[model samples]
Structures are given as structure tokens and as C-alpha cells.
Target: MKILNIYRSEPDATTKKLVEIVTRDRESVEFDLNVDAPDYDKLVDEIFAADKTICWW
Candidate 1:
């Protein structure tokens, strides 16, 4: 299951650890972008490419 996780700034320690464990051998990706300089085009492309998306503010 291709999954995409988007977050502004660094993710919490727990979330980081969980993602590391869960994404092993899995098609899961994460993007950490600046809120002011977000790459809308690339983000849209990833959104379409992924089967599911999770965003954190």
C-alpha cells in the first residue's frame, strides 16, 4: 500500500519511530516541507501517486 505522509517541521519522536517500524519493506514515504515554501506541484504529484495520504500540521 503506497502511503504518503506530509508534515511541516520535524515530526514527533514517537511518530518518527512508529513510521520507521511500520514502513520497513513497505511502500511508504514522508515529506517534510516548509509551510511558507511548500512545493505544491511536487506535493500534488506525490498525492496522486500515493494510494493514501496523511498530513500533519
Candidate 2:
């Protein structure tokens, strides 16, 4: 299973620590951009193109 965590932080020590705690057991992780739109059709199409998408607001 893949986990996607989105946080609203401008890179900080605390954020790092929290991320470490949450992903400590994970052996691998990949970072990617999260795109959103007011147009549901476009947004869904983009999501379908990706393997998985987790949006945070």
C-alpha cells in the first residue's frame, strides 16, 4: 500500500520530526505534486492518470 501525506508547512524541524514518526516504518517513499481544480471533470481525469492521489485542503 502507498501512503500520501499532505501538510501545509514551509519545511521546518517540527514537520520533519512529525513526518519521520508517521513514515518511520516505511521502507520507501516518493514525493509528488498535488494538483486541484474547480472543474471536477479535469480534476478527476488527472487523478485517473496517476496511480493514486490524496488531496489535502
Candidate 3:
């Protein structure tokens, strides 16, 4: 399964561990929105492309 992990901020230790556990042995991609500029267009494409998405705050 393809999973997309979207982070609204830098991930905490718990969040990072959870993401690691959930995405184990699966295809995963991560996108960070904490940058100066985030590409909504690419984010949209990634969302559509993945089977599941997890937003980390």
C-alpha cells in the first residue's frame, strides 16, 4: 500500500515512531508543510496518488 505522511510541523518523537510503525514494509512518502513555501499542487497529487494519508500536527 502507498501511504502519504503530511506534516504540518516538525514531528515529535512519538509521532515519528508511530509513523515508522504504521508505514513499515509499505511504500511511503512524506511531505512537510513547515517550510517557507509548500507546494499545494504537489500535495494534491500525492494525496490522490496514495492509498492513505496521515496528517501530523
Candidate 4:
């Protein structure tokens, strides 16, 4: 299954480990919103394409 991980902020160690465990042995894509200008357009596309989406704050 395809999993899309969206980070609202920089991930902490625990969050990182959990995401690793959840995405293990699966196709995953990561998008970070903590940048100068996040691409909402691409994020929308990814959300539509992914089978599951996880947003991390």
C-alpha cells in the first residue's frame, strides 16, 4: 500500500521511529510543510494519489 506522511513541523525522534515502523515494507512519500513556501498544489495531488495519509505535527 502507498502511504503519504505529511509533516507539519520537524519530526521528533519518537515520531520519526513511529513513522518508520508504520511505513516499513511499504511504499511511502514524505512532504514537509515547514519550508518557506509549501506546495499545497502538490500536496493535494499526493493526498489524492496515496492510499493512506498521515499528518504529523
What TM-score does prediction 1 earn? 0.74
Q: In model 1, which range of ten residues has the least summed lDDT?
A: 17-26
Rank candidates by lDDT, best first: 4, 3, 1, 2
Model 2: how far residue 50 lies from native, Å: 10
Predicted candidate 2 versus true structure: per-residue lDDT over 1-57, tens digit per residue: 344444333436876676667567653243333334245565556555555454333
Clashes of 1: 0
Q: What value does the lDDT take at residue 24 in candidate 1?
A: 74
The residue-by-residue lDDT of candidate 3 on 1-57, one tens digit each, is: 999999999999999999999999999999999999899999999999999999999
Q: Kindly indicate the candidate among 1 and 4 with the higher TM-score.
A: 4
**Candidate 3: which pairs clash?**
none
Q: Higher lDDT: candidate 2 or 4?
A: 4
Error of 4 at 51 (Å): 0.3
Residue range 1-57, candidate 1, lDDT tens digits: 898988876888977876777677779887878567788899999999999887766
